[model samples]
Target chain A: MNIKIVKTDGDVEGLAEQKWVYSPSVKTHFFHPENLVEDVNGFDDSDYNGVGAVGSPACGDMMKMWIKVDPKSDKVVDCKWQTFGCASAIASTSMLSVMVTENGGMKVDDALALKPQNILERLGGLPPRKVHCSVLGDKALRKAINEYFRHSKQFDRMVIEGSVMVDPDTRITDRDIEEAVLEGADDMDKLQKKLKVGIANKDAYAKAEALMGKFMEKYYG
Target chain B: MKISSQVNKLLKDHKKHDIYLDHAATTPMDPAVKAAMDPYFCDKFGNPSGFYEIGLRAHEALEEARNKVAKILNCSSREIVFCGSGTESDNLAILGVARFKGKGHIITSSIEHHAVLETIERLEKQGFDITILPVDRDGFVNPKDLDDAIREDTILASIMYANNEIGVIEPIKELATVCRNKGVLFHTDACQAGCSLDLDVKELGVDLMTINGSKIYGPKGVGCLYVKAGIRLEPIVYGGGQERGLRSGTENVPGVIGFAKALTLCQDDKDKENKRLTQLRDKLIKGLITKVPKCFLNGHAVKRLPNNVNITILDVEGEAMGLFLNELGIYASTGSACTSKSLDPSHVITALGLPYEAAHGSMRFTLGHCTTPEDIDFVIEVMPKIVEILRKISPLDLDSNEVQEGHGNLHYK
Candidate 1:
């Protein structure tokens, strides 16, 4: 037997299957994530028709995606993305990009219907605590689809996912809380800084604060 | 799944992970320590509790190992309680003491190992008032803070000698003095500090201390807790009434022998190893800070362990950096939640009051016996490139949020 030091088993390939902690599929996407926009600043957005983003870097997770839609059939032709997130988030986003554009692309509505559960299932599974990461990709995809609807003058198709309006005046919706939470507004004070919902109207502020709690629990719980 | 099996095989076949930088997690057993333990598994297999000749020999060996460890610790042989592992020792020290008292106020730092923190947490559920003192930016638990937190009902203060994550050594003697003045017991988990620091329990003034074998090039699954003479602790384990009735089980004779040998070796070579490891550690820290942009060290500059270098490189995730580093055969650890099952960033890094985001990019490299100057250089040269790649791939706007105010930035102290 070798004396003092044992070599770290050279099983770099085995890092994919972390037994119960991570499945092989989750690791595959993490180690070799697909459609990664290498430089978001330098990305050529001229080819893309729709752009959407969710979460924030300050929250320790953020994702932005761009998709080109085939207007004739409303099919997503190409997708590119970038993220500041963890293994689960990164892997989910990478798989999301593949899901939208593979086999000549998923229809725009079909892509919008995709959920965190689908992503979680595709990745085999994430640890129960890390289920939040799987939500990043689906949320960003929803944002992109909405952006496409707004741009192409299909106002009827633009829908915010199950969100109620926080302030009908400033047009601050409960959706704003998710974005604000993503942008690092963890508490009411930070939320006030970002959305400024409670400054002029006490009623609006109270509504905003309650919504912020709801969103924080939803995103972080 | 463009994850081509061909590509994975090609990558695996070409790489050799010869570097061993994550010593804070565990260390390889020394050959001498292993050789000394070989006979105990077979030839000296008799139970130390038996009355036969072979049993008597085993009993003598057990006492000899105890004396050797106690001599280094500057404590009596009867004070040392051998247990299964560092976690088990921590459980014995904190739970053993707490369960004896039934229920009372307890004080501990936010940076303690889960073995201490979790045990205390469980105690809290049983109706104990718990105070978790916060640390400063460089992860220092102020002695005055410990002094302030002590109460009339405070039974014990269980703080670590050095943190496993950042290698920041706490003010143990000062903290111990506060507990002594307040008539409360003190325990320190010195698992990470044992190899590099002085283990003289008298000088440190700690009432109890825990040390582990896996961290000191001995066999894993063996740890010792120094319980001051005349101090009472209830047994957490119950069986054959080994370890002075404070522990009950058939003793792990080989593990104890290996642990004593490793502790003796550490005592003999500590100064020289510390000097050599310190040079390498500083070089890696300095080199990474120079090579990478907007990165800062996580712990006290001079008061940290000689072998630990924990830094947070801006604009990247630590797990991504770890995978890239692995590709080059360098194994280190990161504080990124992506790498953990809990999905929460390191509580120690978070306790330093770093923005939650700062915890995502933190990487820890703990040097050990197998590490050479060349390994440090290789990391210094390669780590920055990996960070650069991750930063470019990341979606956050570099300017607006790269140095964004608040959260976890500006942690250098």
Candidate 2:
């Protein structure tokens, strides 16, 4: 009258199997998002040191991050986020929130140093197609750091401007070259026409083209 | 002894408890069809082209299967040409006819399966003029639009019987008649519709129709193209001059037998089963809309397939929902499996004029003969919790006025 169900090692594995098309760490964070601000009203107040948002619903992925910083120590006191995206995006942002707030919070500068690879590594890994999802979290965090500087009137602390260079004479930037390639300018000549790169300095044009080739491999690959 | 025990353990643990709802993607083979195909694999195995008695038997079995399919389709047996799969049948019909005519115009809908759409795209690259007709809000193509788009050089028009994503059935008879009046050969990919609807090819007035085995509980890798008599088609894959030189490959006897048996079994009880599936479909649709707020049904209310229930739950990614449902042993699809991994949203959902968010949030749950009312109840019971969890973490919750305002500004910036 007693039904004895066998429980083997395989059965245990089946029970603990990952269900999502994501790594185990991603599935963990997606289902149990750490420091996820469930209520927008809770974080939309003036107490938040900075708020950063990236992506758009129209683009099928969006993220918003809020950080509370301790003024005395210049460290993040709490970090929270909300995201509308696939499992990878939600998990990436969730891990970002936890990473920033863990261990008594990262220093404002240290949290800004966090990269997409750091978040991705914490979440094990993402599908190649979904690695872009991890980028949103780091981008949003950097935006929050910039917002903090802008609000605190510490414009000199911003470091992103230094990486984005535009030749003063030619008036072209790495961003311009990247945008040109993304907008269907494939070859060097097409990029030259689109950005007018060699008009002033021919050496700068060669440098810009080489830089764009590297960016293409990094982004397109 | 150790390996044997391990094998036993693995076998016992691998027992499936899933309540499959992705029947539109494919179906498990019916037992009757499997039984019919068993002999062909061994005892009766023979190349239909061989000159011996065994070969003649296989040839006869192949002909019998063709006749069974033709009977259900209300077409002559000679018009039926067996092929590998629905995709292959579609490729043969589109590419075959287009290549035979050398160069001309082709018309298809924005919602056609990739088999037809991609084929037409390739044809376009080869100097053939192509026009992709748009669908209405309910994913139905307008007959008037087809009539207006027909040109003097229009050689062929391919439309789907029912959309695989939204499940809305097109007005095939009317659309085909429009093409007929304009001297255009019309083709319909009826792979999704063969089991759920009456597919009398003569009544539908399609010059060419595509039907597959796996969609109707037969084995995969077998389907047929119903080419109306006297329609010229060049061979896409030339080999043994099988299928009367139109298909030209060694006949797949076992797959053909299974397909025929499956089609007969499906046609025999389709009316009663369709009624059951429609009731279950309605219950699931109604339960989801009532339980899950900010959710709406996709596709037409009554013009869709009886087995199909597609819905869009706002502010949640369909892939996330699908994964959650999978944990509860409910297998479903967010969109066409072929395009699910791609970054681009479903073209079929987007073609219905839905906004980007709604299209990104669509899920399709197609029912079948094995689907039951209890399964529907289980899905209804669990779906709301999943939706609530997803929406809680979602950045955009339109129900909250403050969140909507915040999201609007963020979007604008």
Candidate 3:
């Protein structure tokens, strides 16, 4: 005796039902984000050696992070963040803040080594599409580490070479073009609007466009 | 302050209540419609094409449903073609007309559901000329614009009777009149309008119209297309030659019965129910805007559907808000459920000239037969607090004085 099922748009028999299920930890952190900094007014610039922000509001995800370090120990004493994103983003940022500041904070070098997969492991997991959200906190932390080195005047400690503002006064880097393209400002006009690339400097703009074209081919192809 | 107090009181009163406000996606079957369809599914089950007595009875029942639909649309029963769903009806209307003519131009608005939009896109890929007319900020296509878009080779103009996302009812009669004068076939995907608006095809002057069952408290997977008697269409599917050879398959007898019964019930007290829904919808809209600052309505205030209240709260993600509401016993939608899985902003909302942030922040609440003023009150009471919570955490609100001045600085967690 065999039973047959009819496949319809609204299948009442529930044969092929699937849904995106967020882990309990993700739900918990999303509903109540930990160590979120709502106002940055009180935290003075002198007290924090590193400040980093990444993502864009126009692209639907933005995160701003600030870290306070102990001078003698060179450890992240406190970490806080603000974000405009979906549940996964908020949850990931919250978990990252806790991870960095827990046990009297992690060493600067160790914190920079944190990856998105580590954060996802701590938070149980996220949906496949939301795995990108985990990257936000890790990227912002790297930016903060680089900022820390730059602020301390220890240029040798700066590891990641990120995009720099393109102008006649500033040197244009290949990383700058890559960053601009990744942010969806691929064309010259968009690059100018986003990063002010080639503004008042024809040589820089032309160089940036050529590098951007190569990066687009390498990454997209 | 008054709005906040009202919300607080409602929250205290109905903390455990479950309210559903996403009726535009689909509605529960009406009991009468279910009853009408029950016999056909089991005891009265028979092939309508069979020559025996039970089969003849099923055939009569099928025709009776068609007649009921035709009478409502002021068309002959022969003109009504039942298919699987509204998407199928749309495909048949657009593809059918285009294939019948072999090659020509077509005009459609930018705000059509993906069914019409994707169908036109396929035709374009197949070497057919297609013109997508832009809509005004209010999601309305100007009649003169449609007239101007029609070329000598234009074969059809397809516009939706009402939008599913923003709920803006189009000027269908005027648009159809323009197509008629230009000697072009006019089609409207009236799936959303069947339960709320007039269905008189003669009054609308459209060459074709599409209707769906699930949207009107009927069973899903059954839809109808009203093709004018003289218009010829090439069938997309070839099979047992059911549905006048345009749609080939065994007819869904139970679904047809339920659809007809649902249509009759919805029309029975539509005016009164619409009035009730309109007042509740307006109250919800007004309360949300006044209580929750920095929010705006999406579509035309007056020309929109009676049951729809779509609003965008600045600096908030609609999916997050929807999840928050779902945590409570309340259910709503950020946009069409079909496209909600994708993180991209709603195309309909973005077409209205809203920025990406605002489009991503839009939420739609549609009322239905079971909606009540109390449900509206509950939503109003809880909505402002939810918006406030989400807004406090939103990084977009950091620069706005409203967030800074109103909250007196952000509370660090």
Top TM-score hit: 2
Native contacts conserved, per model: 0.41, 0.44, 0.34
Specify the highest-lDDT model's number. 1
The i-RMS of every model, in angstroms, reads 8.6, 13.7, 11.6
DockQ values for all predictions? 0.26, 0.25, 0.23
Candidate 1 fnat reads 0.41
RMSD of 2: 8.4
lDDT of 1 by residue, B264-361 (tens): 99879999999999999999999999999878889898899999999987767887778767666677899987677554578888788776567778
* Residue B9, model 1, lDDT: 48
Reference-based TM-score of each model: 0.85, 0.86, 0.84
Model 2: how far is B299 from its true place, Å?
1.1
Please report the interface RMSD of model 3 to 1 decimal.
Answer: 11.6
lDDT of 1 by residue, A105-217 (tens): 99998998897678888889877656666666776777777888888989988885576766543345677677879877888766654443443346877988887787778
**Poorly placed runs, candidate 2 (over 4 Å):** A1-20, A43-45, A159-221, B1-17, B336-339, B399-413
Each candidate: what lDDT? 0.81, 0.80, 0.79
Off by over 4 Å in 1: A1-32, A120-132, A163-221, B1-15, B397-413
